[model samples]
Target: MKLLFLLFLVINGAHAATHSLKYFYTATSGIPNFPEFVTVGLVDGLPISYYDSKIRRETPRQDWMAETEGPEYWDQQTQVSIGSEQTFKANIDIGKQRFNQSGGVHTVQWMYGCEWDEETGATDGYDQDGYDGEDFISLDLKNLRYIAPVQQAVITKHKWDQNRAQLENRKHYLTQECIDWLKKYVDYGKSTLKRTVLPSVSLLQKSPSSPVTCHATGFYPRSVMVFWRRDGDQVYEDVEHGEVLHNEDGTFQNSVHLTVKPEDLDSGRYECVVQLSGVQEDFVTKLERSVVKTNHGNTGRTNPGAEGSGSSGLIIGAVVAVLLLVAIVCGVVIWKKKKNAKKGFAPANTSDDGSNSSNNTAPKA
Candidate 1:
């Protein structure tokens, strides 16, 4: 009887040792009615047993004496006691470990088992009491590091967009600056050429002939046109062509030469007109010969009365020349008198000859 009792104790202990696993799945469970057998096992929460499966197929069987001990004994002793709450906790802990290892954040959820009632053919996973179907698990991710090349491509595209915006702004600023510079350059050019437009006239020669050549120079040659107007009539044939000179500062200088005959010069009016571009400013200089003779007559013939006046001028020039000559002669005479006075006042040397004569005469006595 003692041996029978010991055997009974052994059977009970073997029944109690039977274990079942609670697996964590993502979306579905029970293998979709395919009868694909799935086994579950548990690992300890301790660091040493973290990855080690503690419950495996090698453990003792649960239904060894089920026929003899009755269904009540099997129900009480053979059934594993894995709670839904415990399995959910384990799965969450494992998920947290994975997140820590990967340096990411994620949310975890567990789906309990569903039940089907045969009378109504209705599926139910949740009721007032609890869930009855196999558990399904899921994770919602946040801050997950992507391992694909598409992630890098997205980052590069964002950076390029920012850079393009900056480049457009810089281009707009530079274009405005360029326009301002161009306006200033044009204004400065106009101001510099405006100062050069003053008219100048010079008489080249006047002595030998009555027909004197008068030259007129003007700035802004592109805007100026030259012609000779004799007594209010333009003489195109007799007008001399002018030469234009270009300056370094984009302005021009031109000279026009005109030869007027003695009779025309004395009788008519000659005008030189200078016109400016973009402006209505016109400059005119008039040359007119005087009817009254000025020392020399307009005909290039010297009048006798004018010649008498020229002789008087010559007499005055000779008087000035005589005075200058007299002053020079007086200066020379004064210099000679001072030199003679200096010679007369100089002390005489009276030593050797007088002393020798005196000594010879004394020796003879």
Candidate 2:
């Protein structure tokens, strides 16, 4: 009986030793195209026996574990011892898992198990709710997440702000340019006003009746003023000036009509003057009329013979002047002929006496 008891004790001790909880933990670089292996240790005093670990890409919903597994998923196991109490270590080899394209975070988790209730030999309920092994080893692994849309939004806002600033600067520059152009136009208009020419003045008509009416016109804007001065004094009550007429292009024209008797027309000079605004130019014109002549009745006396004798004497005098001119011309011709005859005829000369010296010397010799 004592030997059997001792053998039973050894068998129970061996089973107890095999039934202790097991634990393992691991970390990995969870880049999408490249995955690296890492080992982590869980220190606990209990002797761990079994271990299970997995690495996978995370999903959008929580119930993804019940669906069909993807190409990248966690691998779990419960029948191996990774390491011991002082230095428990695990190395997880996760094939390439794409985290960025998967649209979420990637993670790795470790699970450990032990034999619970050996009397009934039940395989289920070996691990606690939140515990992995004797000391509750856990690891959280995540990958880099992409948030490029937010950064793009910030860049777009900056660009819009810069564009708005440039537009405002352009508008201000154009406004200043328009203002300068308007000022130049105003200055040009002022100079043109100063250099404009005045209109020419002339007399149109004069009246000899009781009211002497004269008509005149002007071309400048403010050049229509009509007044009459009698002996250097202004007369305004009896004289009335007409309204000015404006042309299509904003120039002025006017006419003055005055009434004065023939006596007043012969009195003094009436002056019409025109003035311009921008420049100091004044045009003055003076007008007057001559007095009329009158003829009275007269008696005439007749002298028939005297008139006839005067006419006959004029005719005789004209004939005598013609005859005298002819006689003068005939006398000039006779004198010329006599001078030629004297030259042509030879003179009679004597040899010793002075009578026929030319004939004697030519023939006798």
Candidate 3:
């Protein structure tokens, strides 16, 4: 599985008010030491709550969510997730039968979410399902039908589409109920969600001839852009943009590498620019040999703002954490199918790295 996450785009302007609420449900079979079912709920790209078969309970991941919600809320959510767990377990069996697989590791995923633009009063909702790391079916809200990408999913699409009541209920939940909950969450966590923390940028390299890497860490909201600029213009060629990773303390980190010739490095015309959400000022780091820290013996100079010699270790740890997540995920036969899908569904070439109440109804597959 090529696990990748582009959680949210960088929302520009100080008054930008776009928020999203998403739920990811994964059910697996034949995975040792791992939960058979897992659920993650994110609001504006930050995990707010989590549930798993091992825990048998839905718990808050964010302090604001825990503090704002009471026991009754969690109890209700736990029950909702419990019901979903049962449905997904059966769904897995159905998927296996459809794929004609008798045994081995397998996974079934359901992604449903909604996005709201507070400033413009626009709302959108999506629901999608995947079997064995491939797109299966998704709900088309406009037409009120199910779209089946692969032939195996045709029966399921027909079955689910015929249930107009369930379709309407899902549509109402996604468009109306989901947005209401998102607004409440945004209100409850406004203090923490609205807060901004500036990033600490650094320049690092392993050798003089190696590419210069610009690393930014300790930022919040998880929406930021890092790029290499040469002579006041953005440099796209020979530049690699790294994924945004979560820090231990809930902040985020990102990196960009620029391969430059020795002569170009000497010119000092290149700089790294970081643009963070809701921030007016841009963080810039000049590309100078003196400012670049290298691991080559004692010739390197450390940036006071950086984590000193341990900076490389921190970067390595972040990358390893991402790899470990990918490694632990249950393996399945990668399916290749193409079909038009809704918001929660990804394209055929890409697979998503894979919930609650009454606003508490169990999801029906």
Candidate 4:
């Protein structure tokens, strides 16, 4: 298996339907004005293969982004990426104008992420707003509660009472739109895209190549089911099911792994099944014992059996934290030294390393 991870079920709790809708908005300006643009992403648990904003249309999407965003023409970029240089420049000018007219901060920022896991559950979300690098407002979507920027204060202390209901209704409206969009996308995928991108299955084994994995990719709707079978019967003991993963092209990939004993490798008895709508027949792949090649890395993003087991996400988060810390420290040191130098004083650590001569006591950049 490329991504070697054993599933450990601490609590076999009932699972809610995996569904999420994320939205991100950003506005900035160099001209002392601010203009805002909004974009939303809809997914039925995971990414889909096609693009249709009207969602119910058998006809293809007509947005400029739709031409290269469909299953057949998509690049690596996902739907979450929706900004452009032309729009960015326009937004900067708009933001500058807004700032000048509104008589406030030089910049404005807004962002929100919303998710609904259970089919019947309420949508939960996080929202933030800022102006001129300072927090303007923040919200917790799950409880419809407001987060005060100051300590020992109720939301009323922030004047939210004046517009809380209206603001909350806006959040609800956004969530409902996402749900509607997701429903249409799911229907479209099952009825249309599912038949377009055929599943390509690969059997992979790591360097020493012991446990073989049946990997499936280029599928849609997030309704795929994959499992391992032995001699025409589903095997439960040595089988592990992966999560539905979002591919770069807005399609999805998944894998189910089986750890076969050395003696069973050559038996040619292991098979994997991938099922989806519009598939008249199931796509099955048999693990070839003689050719179970070494798996160098991940087969795209594999589904981990358990929730919150994102190795890649965690690693990226940690690396980002470290880099941010280093950058902040470097910025502070540079700012302080420059400020002090302007007052005719060198930094305390500006000693010459090679010699202690007075001539060598000149400033160092």
Candidate 5:
């Protein structure tokens, strides 16, 4: 009986502490057609470990690989993600079909980010789908779910009520996996002096925007602090802080934004400071206005191959659409040719239809 109780505690202990589990499943339309990706983030109240579907590798991988039980999840997660990828693609299509009989115009996506905090109980960082600048089939973790075409019977309330349990269970399962992964990593990191990935800070300014951003990336263990200082004292107000996001190679990045008036750019002095856990040293970068290209006009655009938001680049069936378009054009050409045949006129090697092709018999003049 004691052993059984202890086992229960072993499984349930993670929930009793301050932590978060966020599972992101996304499928978006794009070229090169790499659709469908699922990633899980484990936060022991601060970003700690991550599981990316594309690589099937978990961040803080060294500690995970050290565990005998940990390596098993590598193959297990890969297989599970592979299966979810198809389901997510279908999920994306469901939203696209809602707005468009064929599909949406640009890109379409279905995404879910489930994060549970000690204070908030459970919340979705983001739970929605975007189709051609419109959102549909939205689901919030706290029971505030509504579709865009809600009034028009897009999805009956009956079906949605039934599927609620299933969706919640899926979120729960991923959250449990996160708890296990984070607990193991925290333990592993403490067992030894873990090798550190030093922080790199950059002073940048966005295009067409007056905000100056201080970006810090490529650091490990995830217990990083990034802040802006103005000549010694901490500058609090007017500062925009971004979430800590994982890099492709398992490091973390964050950005702190500050807006400066055009005239005040030269007068105010600013610096970016980065501090990583387990490292006695800190990295500080001086903000240089001349070095940052604020007027370059394309700074806000994201890199396609970069670490964040890879979910927005998944592929949809462009080939089928292209084939359909070509078939329509061909049908139009054939119809015109048949009509010309009835008129006792057909021309080979015709370059611009000209007036001759329309009326080959001299226009009855």
Candidate 6:
């Protein structure tokens, strides 16, 4: 019984103190062999559901979600995504007209989410829209108004702000309905969501002159802090932090780089520290020459390919990285054809129609 109690604590004790549920809706034009409209729902940075115009059906991405939800739930979500698809398609067209563009490659994205702080019982929500990788409009829940960053979106801001019913519905959905759903999801995936996994830390060096990199991978919950310390004090100068990237197994990885003189590197004063949320212990690695993993050879040079193979790059798939959302959306705009489009825009050779007009649904009241 005592061992059973401890086992329960190990499995269910360390949940994410703060949890978030986010939905990303992306609509693109002039992209070849890609979904024109795509929607992804994430809970605590893990993908829960995915929908694309090609599939036309909402599918569960998480095992817990798949086991917990019935066909009716998926069907309802599919219908909602279909409605959102039409809305986003029209929105992108309107945005193009507002920008005074005839035809080109463009993108419109909507990111909305709710965050819950478990300890404090506090909840927050946000709804933001971006066009061409720039902020267009965002909701100010405090004032119940929409803020337009660019002049092209001022019309949309004014129109959305004035509709009191729309404002109320959005607020209620984000704060109340969204929170309810988020809680249900947490409960459904408690076993997996509550478990904590520590990261495997490594110190990698390409060459003697190159900066030393401290890499941490295979961690869970996605909230981790990694930094360099010199003689037990945190080092800020000459340290560069990399973005947290998703591993293929749903774990996360990140790296921090530190540049120091060869003498300083040999002094053994620097150490790397990793702090994972919900875990009390700090994983530390001392900067010792023998302990550092290096590809340096007799000529004090490292193989570029061998060194680069261990580095994390942009992960592409249905499970989107929070930090790489903009990069993924903007970087894929490779020109298949070029026309007399604007300087920043890519030319389009394909029709932009993604859905039938008859199936298009009006925005919810």
Query: Which is the better candidate, 4 or 5, if ranked by TM-score?
Result: 5
- What local lDDT does model 6 show for residue 166? 56
Ranking of candidates on TM-score, top first = 3, 6, 5, 4, 1, 2
Q: What C-alpha root-mean-square deviation, in Å, does candidate 2 show against the real structure?
A: 70.1
Per candidate, the number of residue pairs that clash is: 4, 11, 1, 9, 0, 0
Displacement of the residue 293 alpha carbon in candidate 1, Å: 16
Best by lDDT: 3
User: What do the candidate models score in CA lDDT, each in turn?
Assistant: 0.29, 0.28, 0.69, 0.43, 0.44, 0.68
RMSD of each candidate relative to the true structure: 62.3, 70.1, 7.0, 18.9, 21.1, 11.0
Which candidate model has the greater TM-score, 1 or 6? Answer: 6
User: What TM-score would every model get versus the actual structure?
Assistant: 0.25, 0.25, 0.81, 0.41, 0.46, 0.79
Q: What is the C-alpha lDDT profile of model 6 across 1-365, one tens digit per residue?
A: 34643443343233468777876778888778877887777788677887789889989889999999899878767776776777778777888888998777888877777878888889988877787767778889888998887999887766666667656767776777778788888888888777777877767878888998888777787778888899998877788777566776777777889998878767989989988888899988888776666765322211222233333322232234543354334322221100001110111112133212232232311
Candidate 5, superposed: residue stretches over 4 Å from native: 1-19, 29-79, 101-135, 138-157, 163-249, 255-365
lDDT of 2 by residue, 1-365 (tens): 34543443343223221222222222233445432222221111111111222322222111222243332322211111111110111111111121123323232323322232224533321111011111111111111111122232233223323344332322332233323322332233332222344543433332234343322232443333444556554445445454343332323344445565555555665655544333465555454553211122111111112222222332343454344223222221122211000111112121212223222111000
Which regions of candidate 3 deviate over 4 angstroms?
1-16, 297-365
Clashes of 3: 1
Per-residue lDDT over 37-131 for candidate 1, one digit per residue giving the tens place of the 0 to 100 score: 11121111000000101221112122222222344432322122112223333433444453354323222222112222223433222101001
Q: On residues 1-365, what C-alpha lDDT tens digit does candidate 3 reach at each position? A: 01211211232222336788877777889878888887777777577887788889988889999998889878867776776777778878888888899789888877778888878998888888888888888889888898998999887777666666666767877887778788899898888777788877888888778998888877776678888889998787787767666676666777888999877776879998888877888988888877777786434333334446336535664775464244324221132211101212111111111122231333434
TM-score-superior candidate, 1 or 3: 3
Global lDDT of model 2:
0.28
Off by over 4 Å in 6: 1-15, 297-365
Please provide, for model 5 over 1-365, each residue's C-alpha lDDT reduced to its tens digit, 9 standing for 90 to 100: 34643443343233322333333333445424332343333333232333333555544334443454454545444544454455445544554555455533343333333334445555334435444334444544445444444532345333443455434543443345334543444455443323466765555665535687777665665566677778876667777766555454555566678776665456557766776765778777666555453446322322212432222111111233243223222221122211011111111111122122222111000
Comparing 1 and 4 on TM-score, the stronger one: 4
